[model samples]
Target: MSQSASQVYGAVQALTQSSDTLFLLLGAIMVFLMHSGFAFLELGTVRKKNQVNALVKILADFGVSAVAYFFIGYQIAYGNNFFVGAETLAQGNGYELVKFFFLLTFAAAIPAIVSGGIAERARFYPILIATFFTVGFVYPLFEGMIWNNNYGVQTWLETHFGYGFHDFAGSVVVHGVGGWIALVAVKYLGMRKGRVRAGKHTNFAPSNIPFLALGAWILCVGWFGFNVMSAQAINGISGLVAINSLMAMVGGILVSLFAGKNDPGFIHNGPLAGLVAICAGSDIMHPIGALITGGIAGAIFVYLFTYLQNKTKIDDVLGVWPLHGVCGAWGGIAAGIFGQTSLGGLGGVSLVVQVGGTVLGIVIAVLGSIVVYGVIEKCSGLRLSEEDEFNGADLSIHKISAINED
Candidate 1:
């Protein structure tokens, strides 16, 4: 090759690489902000006594996820080889850094999701440990199967079914996993003090509305990066994903407002429902399809939240299951319907395949969470003592109190 030609090629390659790096970095930054949203939202929902604990857990989860992803979780999730040694590390070198950022956000999510359930009473140290195991190992394993291009479950699905289970962003992988974990954690932790007394129930109002609203807005903003950047390409498709995400949020807002008789709590959760619902097919769905999908998700969130809170005794402080798990399922299924090429090159696979994938993802998530939480509870004890529960984990466990001293 001529010297000038070689130089030009090298320069172009460098530019492309730099551009890709920049996009990934931006996506990482946005995903990081989601932790803040989760923190503020959770703090708003729980009583003041648990505020500090919630904040600390949110911060600590990010740190734990970072360390775990760097050491082994990244490799386990995306590496070409699974053998433990220098050879495995060498084979996994190039992808480690990118996987670290991607999986760290994912790991952070698991703890964030579970935090709501154990709000008000659980010990801090144990919760931290659970976060470590969840993000470090459990969450990564599922993510590996879902997104890892080389040897993931997606690959198996493609080989066996002739069409891979699609999750353009991570409805089934991220939110679904988090929701199941929250369910198990809540079940194991039992109910918050006074939640059930002599067969009667107690109502717990949000401690701060402004905080919740701000958190919801933050989540809505971060979702742009979550859905659009998942495409990993900065072109027309990315723009489409961004539009879908926005539309979905708007749809969620409208649906929740109308469906719930203008309930503020439902309104706050509606945007999340839209985001989660659209995640499965955000990359491919048309703008209008996204609206419908998001609206349905919002409605589902209202229904599930009410059912769980009023009909059942599940004390899901932040409604993670309804917002993430159920909506994630809706998103995945919506992809199968709206992804039809007629809509925007979305649905083509048989309905049975789509349903199977959704069912399989949920089953795996639920069972995995059950086992992980059960083991953690047995080993370290998941909840605080009765006295500590009354005193609040923030004070009893962390030695810091949110209460003002006279």
Candidate 2:
């Protein structure tokens, strides 16, 4: 090759490599902080009796996902194969590190999402076991199918339809997966003690709103990495992703502020709704499109949370389904609608296909988790005893009490 041509090639390669490395590092750090978000969010929602259990589950999830992702999750999700001929695992150097770090964030998110459903009642050891299977096998398998360039959903989409199923970020893959698991967990664990009785109603308010707000803020900040870094190429699109994410978040806040009739919980959940709504299309959406999408997401979350909690009686303590699952579906569909090549040269997909993919993801995640949790419940018992639950899982499972009457 000519010297000038070689120089251009070398420069392009270096820039690509640098972008990948920088985004990977930044994304990993941001995602790690989301654990703090989970901790405080769960702690704020559950009663004080279960505070320690919430803390332990969040901390353990971070640690467990780290180890599990390092050993197997990475290989399964981003590895070249299901079991063998995995190039990322072969040398364990170069781009492998980037892939590893990226997958770690995803793995960590799974258990954190489910913690909301099983809050205040599940046995600690069983929760840990569920996290193990989730990160180690279930998440990896689905993630690999969607993300791994050669052998998963991308390949399938390419072969069948000329364009691939584009997630831009991981609305269905990560958030959707986690939300489904949470639903299943709640079903298996049943409602908190005295939450429902002979068709009567009861109120279970959050223990601390400040903590919930703090967690929500952390999640909003970390989402920058979660969405922008997923570009996997951190040049122009990365900046666009960041802008879209912020726009959506702001829109969500504004919409919720108005829609909530000045309710703090609705306002606090707005940014989360926005974050979920933009995850699938952040890289592709115009600023206006993002803003609208986020605003709608925030409004929807406010309504859904009330509807689910009050009417349906699905006690999602942290509103994971509304914030993550429902808005995730919105984001996925928005990718198909608002996405435009003319805006930024990012081609849009068919709305039909996008909706199909989104629905498929939700169904699989919900049903799969239900089956898995059902088996676990039958085999080892998932819920704590009534006495233990009433007293609190913190003291029952960990032998630690949050109350100190002294």
Candidate 3:
């Protein structure tokens, strides 16, 4: 090639890299905004007295998560760190930095998910420590294995099952792991004070329906970035992923409307259930298949959440286990089913691998949650005192209430 041709080629390549960086930056921003959704969702779900604590914890957790991921978690998961010179980092149009920002949002989501389940009664500092260790160590372990293909786990799956595990956007990696991890924290922390007095479970209503609905909306809108931008490049973007996500969201809504008996809480959360379930297969599943996957997930969330609260007495505040944990696992398996050529999906997904990978994720999350939360409970304690609980987390922890009197 001539000198002019080389120059033109270099310019085009630079432009492509710049565009990709900007695209991913937008996606990172959207996913980052989803943290606010997590905050308000918890705030609206918990009792009025604990609303301020809910808002504070989510923001604090995000800040801690960024620090942990930057210093240790990102390198452990991807075998790269930011210890190099700024000039070296600026190469590749600083895409690596923005990519870190994108994945950091996903990493921070682990503690954000757990925050909902253990809301209202958890001690502030202990929970922050949990966030640090979780984002810094536990989440990155499985993340490395799945997304980064560390330890040849993906290779082993493909070798054994004729295809690798296919989680296009972290059904098991983010939502599954976060949801399952939240379960341990919830169970260990136990029910809130008076939550199960007289052998009867208390049915606490959401403090603000509009706030809850707003959270659901923000999450729903941001999910496009979560799913569609997993491709990580403009050239790799697909309308299929976007449409599948939309179909699944609608499916979750319609199913939850009927299954939840039109309860506003369930109705609002229904779309989240669908989106969680569709994350794994959005790239491969047809829109119709995504709908079915999401619909089932919606039903699962409503039914299991009720069972957990009433029968099992788990006291998971936001039903994170059913909505994210179980639904996310279902998504992993559904990807194998719905991504099959016979199901009107793009093939090359394996059921055996999907199930195996999902199970691995569960094991990692469960063990990690147990060890981290367990140690914390044994040492510094996890729950608030009965007096503190009665007074509410806002006044007890943050020294303020959600609503102030003039």
Candidate 4:
């Protein structure tokens, strides 16, 4: 039997939609696993006394973010909702639904970044509230502006600078904002007990180097999904993003290995700095450009982290600001340079526009964090009690240690 041409076209459309839905779902799952990476990373960094708390907090925060993003964040960012009837919702192979799941993972990352900075001393419920608030409100505002062009923000940028800010996988949108917000959290939470002496950090070393390495490895592996799957559909996927991400990661590892003077902590975290920086330009950048960007991010993390600990006495527990905030901003700007055709990129970027966007994200992050965290601190307190700090977050908040005994 001969079929109508329209029927054939419709069939092809269905198949494409189904394939795209599957692709995004896989990406969401991979990103979902990165939360565990967050868990183990913090778990490995803090003392064993606070290990259990670190694990519990990250998992719990994911739960909070899910609700906030689902109920509010998505609507604010893209002006969409899932309130339609079941039959209507089932259309397009549930592609929109899967996309929401994928982006929810990104929104959740904001709190995950904050978790590392304020670990060991923040009250659990308060942090959860802040996570909900930021993911639901603060992050989506800027995310909508840049990604969705809400309130003509992207339009304005392109009109004035010949290009809008281009963050292929959210260096500024996610990592930068998270990192900056983390700085505010850490500042308000203050240093852990015995963490400072006179004018320097007390230098409490990582509790579990193996766990730290494991966490880094997980995130490294998962980042391919983070950058590649960012295409969000089968047709848009590109191998350039994958290779770029790899080269950048390697660059970070080697650079930090040398710059850090054989410190295992820096060696593991080096790739992360690279990954964060490459997120904005991975799709547009050549492999060599990515390597340079990653290497620079690694050096930035090592040098600044050391200076903060040794001289400034800032207690950014895991150096989230350097690794994510500063490196994330670098990624945003690096895209403007590396993504230009003259430098082996696809070239739809402007350095001026990139800088403006980076600064805007940072300013939004700073103001939003101050307002949200400050209000919470004043209303209900953000940190654990002095006694709780001495006893560790595990024993103080959860009533159990990572290793319990009779």
lDDT by residue for model 3 over 243-297, one digit each (tens)?
9999999999999999999899999999999999999999999999999999999
Summarize candidate 1's per-residue lDDT along 1-406 as a digit string, tens digits: 9999999998987676556656766787898899899999988888888888888888987887777667767667777333456555443223334535755786678788778766887777777777777777777777777777535566667777777777888888888778877887888887788876778777689989888888888998998988877755344337778888999999999999999898777898899999998988887789899999999999999998888877677888888988888898888888888888877655545445566778877787778778777887888888889998887768887888876787
Could you arrange the candidates by lDDT from highest to lowest? 3, 4, 2, 1
The number of the candidate with the highest TM-score is: 3
| lDDT tens digits by residue: candidate 2, 1-406 | 9999999998988777766677677777888888898888888888888988898889988788877777777777665433445564444234556656766887789899889767888887777877887888777777777677535566666667666666878888888878877887877777777877778757588888898898888988888878877765556446788899999999999999999888877898898889888888887788888999899999889998877777765877778877887888888888878886664436756666677778877877777777678778888999889999888877898888876778
The segments of candidate 2 whose C-alpha lies over 4 angstroms from its true place after superposition are: 1-19, 80-94, 149-152, 341-345, 403-405
lDDT comparing candidate 1 with the true structure? 0.79
| Per-residue lDDT of model 4, residues 1-406, tens digit only | 3568889888999999999999999999998899899889989999998999999999999999999999999999999988889898789998999999999999999999999989889999989999999999999999999989999999998998889999999999999999999999999998788876675567889999999999999999989989999999999999999999999999999999999999999999999999999999999998999999999999999999999887764688889999999999999999999999999999999999999999999999999999999999999999999998889888899988898576
lDDT of 4 at 194: 85
Error of 1 at 171 (Å): 0.5
lDDT agreement with native, every candidate: 0.79, 0.80, 0.95, 0.94
- Comparing 2 and 4 on TM-score, the stronger one: 4
Q: Which stretches of candidate 3 lie over 4 Å from their true place?
A: none
Q: Which candidate ranks first by lDDT, i.e. highest? A: 3
Clashes of 1: 4
Name the better of 1 and 4 by TM-score: 4
Q: What is the lDDT of residue 205 in candidate 2?
A: 80
Q: Please give the RMSD of candidate 4 to the true structure.
A: 1.3
Clash pairs (backbone) in predicted model 4: none
